[model samples]
Target: MPVIALLLLDGVPGPHVTTPGVCFGTAARCHPRVAYEVRLCAAPGFRSAGGPGAFGVTTPWGLDGLDTLAEGDTVVVAGHSGHPDGPPPGVVAALRSATARGCRIGAVGAGTFTLAATGLLDGRRASTAPGLAAELARRHPAVDVAPDGAVVVDGPFHTATGVLGGVDLFLRLITLDHGDAVAVETERQMFLELYEPGPDQGVRADAPLPGDALGPTLGWLEARLDRPLTLDDLAGHAGLTVRGLSRRFRAETGLPPLQYLLRARIQRAQRLLERGDEPVARIAARTGLGTPANLRHHFQRYTGTTPSVYRAAFRSLVTSLTPPREVPPPGPGGPPAR
Candidate 1:
């Protein structure tokens, strides 16, 4: 069991603050073998949601209470804070101290703004919502920023694009710490339905090709995701000369075989990233993208955002939609496909 200290900001959106607590709360409460302990730590006497007057809420510990941060623990920073331009000095100190002690750090949406304040993201990769990317880049020119993905896990730091997908990013982190089976079981138990990974992994075919030689050829192309299949290679698989296969494939698909293959490759890479926590290197290999550099190169050209950013945004979006599976029944259980 891992204890997750979820750091709340002054302006964190109501949904971002409450949903993870409810979802993970349910998951941890029901599961016998694994338990995820979550602590809601806010600035001293600072109440973000359901104010003292409305819900009579109060934080157990302010910044001073942040002493719980230590090794083998995680610090999750939430967004929608009143002052996202930066975190309070004391809060910043806590995050820096946590990092010094080897505590894993994560931020959601605008929360990345605070992490960047510490100079830890310099030359390191991170993600934020598109609305704030330019400002993030403008303020900290040294930190790499990706604003489209639901979330981005760079080194020990995890970032989300917006408040929408914070829970998904958190679940992915749990999956990274535990395992897929645990993560999936929790999800199933929670009955979460709002989560949609990314990119389409299904093979596309207008069934009954009417004796189209290129029909099986498409499946063959998909099968060789791990191997580089050039036009010649595809032609070989189709049992035709290079010119013949190229013409046929293009005529049938309305695109050149190479172009279609590249699109398919990028889409598959996307699915692997959003649903599975495979490293960019492994995904690159499995998708025949070869290297991380190559994956980023193709991903940027196709999606206008790097794969890293795309993953972050995807996670953030998922989290925002799907509350913790731990929430009492009928909380949030959406379909699990995009």
Candidate 2:
């Protein structure tokens, strides 16, 4: 239930004029119950993005800047920060003071440049929208920028890919604080399909994949998890080369062909574990994991537990149950330590 301060840096485009405002507003709606106390602040003498008649803004701290920033609070700067060469005098002073007081600061999109100017991003993995990725690295030698990600959370800082992908970043922060069950529902309730968390890239909905045939093949693969389909078979089915299939799968699902197939098997195993009490070997064979040992190899690698243990751990929801530890040890000599 900690409070967060989402400081709207001076000279940013009004939310009504940009997507950041839309994303933040929608996030507030979705997680109404989470204890997030968000406050918006503008430096002294700030007005709307358009010169003349901007909405009148006032703050407790006169244009003194960062004076209003509280220590140990989370600060989020949004939209384009009018200064790219470096942070404005007021912005720079405030960022330094806030960091000196141990505050966590972040920016959405180009705002990252401002954070970079503060030197807090030095040696940190931060990101901005795709276009600005190179500029951020070039301008600030200390920051380690990700080439393709909608958001990057390095240590205390949380950054976004700008106006369109800020919500994903915000919700990711929320998930780190709250949980994914809430994060998933929040995305489902408020965002476009592009905002989904699986892909760090904020790919637009209109973009095309490797080829038109890859789409149907992806859907076909998703629908037929019960079948033993290999990477070669998938490539053949899509009329794509193996390399082409790998690239397209990475583009579409943000995972390689074999990795995606492994996930599909795990997901299938999870469903079977939850719905029925079948032997691990049976579930493995049915889901194309081949054997219980193979299933445990991937299962433990991904979920940190074996199939029966996972089943027992999850099955406690519906009936008077036994915890995983009491389920009698895993079968003999089968990947002994798993």
Candidate 3:
């Protein structure tokens, strides 16, 4: 099995260690065939921070363990309280060596600063906690810091901000290793909504939307998803000309107005399919896809599965994980008691 080594440094935050553990553990339980070996590799004399109480953390592996990782394995640097001061001694070299051996490197929250200190993230796009974004950029001007991104994957370097952002990153990693089905199953088992990576490939969908200029217009568009909206309608709502709206919209969202609208419709359809028993025709109409056939074409094109199959697969996964409730043994009535 491929290994996932979480490098725990001094003053490591508790969640950084537990998030990956839970995420990968859940994925393993859901699909053992693609399970990865999760290792908590700590630095010498590592301790927990920002928890109920600080405590010593002993691990089977240390910083040197990073050298053992190879192509299929991954090493994630856990965020630490000393992140602003840069990585401790031997960390930068150990991480660099791991990168040389083709081990994929990742970081969570302030851990991005640790990875950045090694010069590996220089000239690469990354994200840290929103509050530390400016400091990270100031310290490492070569690194492109996208403060608004929940998670940013540039090449083999993956970085995420905050606790939930770490979960998103690991889920994405699971998706890449296994498949969408396994990832979705893991998400459901964890009682988390299915997460879809943004169209930009690296960022999550919750990243900042269009600027204030089109904020209200975007809300207006969302309120009218069931309507057959035209480009002119969007422009009029934004109080801008069609050409201007197209330019600003593309600049902010990286897609044309209609293209973005189609994606939004498809996403809404997905939510409806997952959360309700609505038929494909009804969902299609509600999402403004016009008909079940059109919905299937676009949904399959975008999500790689037909609407019915998608719904059945998700529902079946949920059913498999849910415990069966016991029924009362015919409470002295002709019909079974509810």
Candidate 4:
């Protein structure tokens, strides 16, 4: 089982500690094969804060829990009231050490302040609680504070707002470690007991179309992900002129047809790299990238890392660190429709 160390610092709210445990623990109970052994550890200076006046907090582990972040382990820094300008000494060192050791590091709420203080998030895109994002950006010029999103996954580091956001992060991790089917099952269980909606239930209004009109064409393209597709071919299949196809495709997918194909190919490449043992060359062929060299170019362009590095970081559970991947900036046109 993968170990998840919850690093608790002084003045941390109680929920920040328990939420991850509940999320990972429930998933573990449901699927032991993908279970995480959660360890709540007291940082160099841990104290309970932000709970009900009558409540208190405690943990069984301390700095030694940092050791659990060996290969497939994760270390999540719980939010605290301590100085963001200067977090506790041992904790910063520990976080840096964990990064070097290939651990997937995460911060929650104000805990992002501590992460920023460590210089790990420098040049990486991250998100914190909405109210704290600007402050984090102001404090760390190298860290790009994402304008929106409750959960943000860069490379090895993940960050979220608070308890609910942490849940989103854990669910994502579950999907990465297991698969969508298992993640969906676990999510259904969470909702059955907590009366909460799953992530799919929350849709953004400004998001791209669900491909209603282009559904059949979208399905055709996805089914032929390995094909050497082209704009003219797509237009022919859709029974429309190239210009007409571009207009409707952009209207629905919010991306030009070629760009959309690239995204889809890269997405497929990522899945194969993470869950399969196929060689990079073979994956490239199957994803229709033609060659490993070409695959590397587009993979790095979109995910900011090579397929090998991405696989190493996630497949091994935690062991490689690469810069966070960026979403492709918006462009024109979109995929084919029929």
In terms of lDDT, the poorest run of 10 residues in model 2 is: 200-209
Which scores greater on lDDT, model 1 or model 4?
Answer: 4
The TM-score between candidate 1 and the true structure equals 0.54
lDDT of 3: 0.78
Provide the overall lDDT of each model, using Cα atoms, as 2-decimal numbers.
0.70, 0.64, 0.78, 0.74
Is candidate 2 or 4 superior in TM-score? 4
lDDT of 4 by residue, 41-146 (tens): 8877666655533245768888888965786688888777774647876878889999999999988888888888889999898888777788888989999998
RMSD of 2: 20.4
Candidate 1 lDDT trough over 10 residues, lowest sum: 200-209
Among all candidates shown, the one with the greatest lDDT: 3
Best by TM-score: 3
How do the residues 210-269 of candidate 2 rate in per-residue lDDT, one tens digit apiece?
Answer: 454466776677676667888889999888999999888776656677776776677678
Superposition error at 245 for model 2 (Å)? 54
Of candidate 3, the 10-residue stretch with the lowest lDDT total is: 201-210
Candidate 1 vs candidate 3, lDDT winner = 3
Please provide TM-scores, in order, for all candidate models, with all chains considered together.
Answer: 0.54, 0.49, 0.58, 0.56
Q: How many backbone clashes does candidate 2 have?
A: 2
Candidate with the larger TM-score of 1 and 4: 4
The digit string of per-residue lDDT tens for model 3 on 1-338 reads 89999988888767776778788987765443556888989875575554545666668888877877999799988888888776778889999999988988999888899999999998899998878899999999999999774789898998887555378779888988877756765775565333333444211112133344667877788778999999999999888999999998777666788887887787678778899999999999999999999999988876667888878887886687454665758766568666
**Model 4 RMSD to the real structure?**
19.0
